[model samples]
Target: MSLTKEQTQHLYHKLLDMKKELSGEKKETESMTEEVGELSNGVDNHMADHGTLVTDRMTDQTVREIDRELLEEVNHALQKMKDGTYGVCEKTGQDIPYERLKAVPYARMTVEAQADMEDELETDAPSFEREFHEQVKDLSNKETVDQKSSQTYEILDREQDSK
Candidate 1:
């Protein structure tokens, strides 16, 4: 079903709000150096403290990346709105459901189309990688009565024993 004028306007405002929020959040996230509150990069601190700082920095970076991606999506949605194509599924050329649009204003595909695309991506994995994943799953499901009777079980036992 096509979006009503009110629905389109509602989604447009939602996208704008999301864009503003994401942009502000991206700026507000403290940088590693700012968060340190120290004169240097923790060189004079305990190794564990330094490690924690590194981990914190990595986490902050990941958050920023996510915010950046969301901001991009919001901008794309805004552009689509300007182009008179908001609420339309890019993949299937269908009018995206109002409920889904309400939930994810920047969504470019319908839920079913998105799931199908994800399934296609899974199937598009390299044959060797898929085979390796299947092998791992199969091994995980199999059991051996005795470690000595199964080479896989023996190796796993050895690794566990060493650990």
Candidate 2:
């Protein structure tokens, strides 16, 4: 299925927007890395008190992961633009809806194909009970920490009263 000139232009514009967004994200990641480097050498008392090293490292990792995904999508869209298949679905020979392509220029599957793939993934994954139990276990650990902190605070208050 071939797109009209207008449709092609629309998809091209969408791809351009995605490229711009990814570039901005890449810059943000670079800035974050620089900040992390600066913090590593700093002796500021606030930095020591906040203990944000772990949080910064995790944030940098998350940003890098997102940047990688965005770069992949940008590359895929550029490839499709080169091949004149920008709006066509990889799974079906049909032309993907313009709205969908506008929303996700790198999408390889039509809506129906995407839905089918999601359904297949859902069936292949472990049962909800297993996932629920894992979540419950995580929440229980957090609750335990909260309880411990509260008890410690109560004991400290009682000691202050006695003093």
Candidate 3:
């Protein structure tokens, strides 16, 4: 079933509120240089300190990008509302449940369709489990070699002591 007028209005307000909040947050975001102040210009700082600064800048950039993406999603949802397509799954052309809409006012697809899409993406992605197992196997082999080297060193020390 389609959403009632009152329900749509309620969701519209929710989306507007979310958009306002995200917009305000985006505006408040500061550049890493501004946030770090003169500390970034200090030549007396250690290499680790410089590395941390770089990492912090990268993290900040990532967060800003994520916020930008979410703001775009919120804008898209607002546009969909105007287009009279809100609360309908974009993928299946079916009515999205009101409860789901209430929980995630910006959702574009039904839960099932979203899950199916995620599964499809996962199928296309590389196997994380396989990569992890290979890393573990390599570490185990390195450990064994280190242990053997340590034993040989001990044996040589013992022979030197006897001499």
Write down the TM-score of every candidate.
Answer: 0.68, 0.59, 0.68
Residue 84 miss distance in model 1 (angstroms) = 0.9
Task: Quantify all predictions' global Cα lDDT against the true fold.
Answer: 0.76, 0.68, 0.76
Of the pair 1 and 2, which is ahead by TM-score? 1
Model 2, total clashes: 0
Per-residue accuracy of model 1 over 1-163 as CA lDDT, tens digit each: 8999999999888888888787773345566667566635545666677578787676567657667777899999999989998888899899999999998889999999998986786699997676554444334343643335554455557879999
Which pairs clash inside model 2?
A: none
Q: Give the C-alpha miss distance for residue 20 in model 2, angstroms.
A: 3.0
Candidate 2 vs 3: which has more lDDT:
3
lDDT of 1: 0.76
lDDT of 2 at 68: 68
Superposed model 2: Cα runs more than 4 Å off: 24-51, 126-163
CA shift at 92, candidate 1, in angstroms? 1.2
Model 2: what TM-score? Answer: 0.59
- Across 1-163, the per-residue lDDT of candidate 3 in tens digits comes to 9999999999999999988987884445566667466565667767677578777676567556666777898999999999988889999999999999998899999999998987776677678754443333333343544453544345557879999
Please give the lDDT score at residue 86 for candidate 1.
86
- Assess candidate 3 and give its lDDT: 0.76
